[model samples]
Target: MRSLERHRDVAAYALGVLNEADAFRFEDHLMECPLCAARVTEFGPVSRQLMLYRRATPRAVHPLTGPGPRLLDRLLAEVALRRRAGRRRARYAVAASVVLAVAGPALAVLAGGGAGQPVRVEATDARSGVWARVTAEDRVWGGEVELRVKDAAGPRPCRLVAVGRDGTEETVTNWATPGRDARPHTLRGGTALHPDDVLRYEVRATNGETLVTLPGA
Candidate 1:
């Protein structure tokens, strides 16, 4: 298998998505590849983050009272069992220093909003009719694209369009409405596009001749 495919499989293994045979194959690869092993180690932190969130948001126990200590205790027990099973897996140790070296700069950039930039698009998913978020410097509207206004002075009507790299475009605006905050709006009866393949999104406002385009296209 190619290195990228192996890495993807490693991620899937870390995410607990691999079957037994694939898991064995990956384990054998991990023994000889220090870099792949290190990448696999990143999953430890990801798993911990998942666990923390799960603990913070326990399942509701009572209709009115919500989750209680009993639920937390059961969750803890499950986590402990999983940890014990993980201990039996092949130990491809990744140095703590290496993890810190790579994580420091990544964390800094993500904290600075350098990673949260939205992609602008000219169309919506032909199947799903949902547009990806677009970044704008000021209020503007054009074509099938609509701006996600934080708080407009009055009610704003918007339409979403999904466009693919294959030159396929789908536009939906039948149920669009304005809101006080920016929330994901969906266009019904449209197929969802793969994140990697989405070319752009188109946004347009009601009664306006202009259209807004976000970067994805």
Candidate 2:
């Protein structure tokens, strides 16, 4: 029951191929249309799965590069339709989430630490491919967190979220790797909190999956 233009836009938007202007417009529309929003959500992960399948097929080079015309669209649309009849539903490429609308820069220098030394900590995720390091200067009231992710993000978008002691999550940055290769990319976010004000750091998939969390002190 959707128009062809609507379908095309939905497909393009999901694949991250729509031009900036078009994408911005569609995103505005997404805030209003639950159906379109739902469809876009499924395409990212489905595309990643398809990309993996193509790579394993042994004859695919850059197969499924764009979700606009790939098999991902058909599969997700079918699923979305069934769900509507039943149930369902950025990266260095940044989120338009209200929580991050006023976030700080990607990196900030640490200072304070009582004697000009910043506090530092490290933690790794269960997958073992991702880890986070934190450094905060007491008097500066902010810190820098770095994430080194390996072979864990390429098929879908991943986010580094900085959680404050008060439970507010500010997005540090978002990234999606190219193809099935997760060659260890690093993400840095400068948070606006005192060294001790940070409660934890989280690495999550755009789908609301918490990939990992590093406790802060």
lDDT of 1: 0.45
Clashing pairs in 2: 91-174, 141-193
lDDT by residue for model 2 over 1-217, one digit each (tens)? Answer: 2455665687776655788777666655665555665566456444444433543454655654554566777777765664453222122212333335556566454422333345666666766356555555443224554556664444555566778889876665555433356565555445555557778777776567887787766
lDDT of 1 by residue, 3-91 (tens): 66776786686555788777667665665565665555455446434433444454864324556569878877876765554454313
Model 2 worst lDDT run, 10 consecutive residues: 86-95
lDDT of 2: 0.57
Per-residue error for 17 in candidate 1, Å, reads 43
lDDT of each: 0.45, 0.57
Off by over 4 Å in 1: 1-100, 103-157, 176-190, 206-210
Return model 1's CA RMSD, one decimal: 23.9
